[model samples]
Target: MEAEDGKLKCNCPSGTFGEDCSLGVCEIENPCLNGGTCVPASNIADTPSCICPPGTFQPVCEQCYYNFTRDAYIQLDSQVMLAINSLNQTQCDEECDKDERCTFNFIGLDGCYIFEKPVIFASGNGDLNKYKERCMQMEECLLLTHILEDNKCFLFNVTLNNALSILRLIEGQHGNNIAEKICC
Candidate 1:
């Protein structure tokens, strides 16, 4: 074939296309894996190279092969617990869910960790209803403490002591009165 300006025109070979008939079209026979795109090689006619993204590795760039899994750590104030075991996020969650004692949680590049929440249940209280009630009450107390501390109360340090004293006094005065004073 010839162009209007008399330049020679050539059809791209099967599975190839471009101005110079130099780019190879990706086909089932030459599939790209790991989500890579076919890019034309600098000097290779009708041939292309697969470009894979980070964290993914494969010959054709069709299947994603992650080099790393999710990491997790427990953050308590200034303390940071390092990764327990290397695993993906789903595995981390599964491990945490399998443990009943675990509470709050977060995921990171290393894995996942169970945040240390204060245990509200006293010894021997394994009943679900009792546990729920205790957790709710403890949450309220913690919230009150946080509020008082935020307000910069000078006696905030003694709040627990004061509460204990009040409970003792109520118990001494009347057994029924103690039950009434506690939040339902």
Candidate 2:
């Protein structure tokens, strides 16, 4: 839900309750349709209000603002694709979308940047102050596809790769073996 003053607007369906619209409604998770907050179902108040953004209506954040993460940082050390020239949050997402090694990473100097992946350790204050980060627009495009494993090159649903696969796993010392499973 679009949490403003923590006052949620439960947009529960016809016969439902709670901040999230899940209780009476078994349709979806959280039940807070359209990014609404599921209010706690009470004898007094029944129905979840979907706290949508200003321009959005109920049921979902349909016309509302796009969702993004904030205060994110890569853990431990940075496997940084270094020397990005002045990047903005949009560019950060764009970069993450393009990179294969980047599970998720973001610049720490801006308002908020977000990338989604597993968790890693955050950098220390001393390390954080060492370098400068910028978000200026630049002209660059990087497409990387390499053999990460013996016979496996990850190439499905890459953020910017247009759902295409690149490279074929050739023979290896361990005798190249290719088994296709759900993208792990």
Candidate 3:
């Protein structure tokens, strides 16, 4: 306690509170969630704040994060796949896993696999023209996918020139449509 204006006032240390600094701020109940750490407020009247971990946010860390189980992966459709001739699933997996630049292996639902660097830029609900205009604004965007059912756009930095080297388009096949960046 320190004397201020002829009256003694209680001053608590870090993380401690109450009349004599005898109680802990986090002693009663912790409010932080999703691996977040609770930090006691400097003033006794103020509430504690939470330090959220990676892939989590908000006051108590209650937010949507990619919470996938171990060994889980998302399967890509044919439109985004790069055709590697004469290579089976095992061979494709081995080749992609060995390549240092190929961090993500996009295994197609039809048993095909892509070796391209899957650097996704943006994804949101929009029409084809809207996605194309948005992609054109970004110099790095090289590919775009617009899902008709959900009206979702997925922009990527994968080059068409690079994709053309390995991909062989199957004529008349239908699913998702991929738009490549065209030069003037």
After superposition on all CA atoms, what RMSD does each candidate show versus the true structure?
22.5, 17.6, 13.7
lDDT of 1 by residue, 5-63 (tens): 77777776566666776546654334555566766556544466777665333445532
What is the C-alpha lDDT profile of model 2 across 63-132, one tens digit per residue? 3221111222111112222335568768876876786655544556432233232211112132211211
Q: Considering summed lDDT, which 10 consecutive residues are worst modelled in model 1?
A: 147-156
- As for lDDT, the candidate ahead, 2 or 3, is 3
Q: Give the TM-scores of the predictions, in the order they appear.
A: 0.23, 0.20, 0.31
Positional deviation of 181 in candidate 3, in angstroms?
A: 0.9
Tell me the whole-model lDDT of each prediction, alpha carbons only.
0.36, 0.34, 0.56
Instruction: Write down the TM-score for model 3.
Output: 0.31
**Which residues of candidate 3, in runs, are more than 4 Å off?**
1-117, 164-175
Error of 1 at 165 (Å): 18
Better of 1 and 3 by lDDT: 3
TM-score of 1: 0.23
Off by over 4 Å in 1: 1-82, 119-184
Locate the minimum summed-lDDT window of 10 residues in model 2: 132-141
Best by lDDT, which number?
3
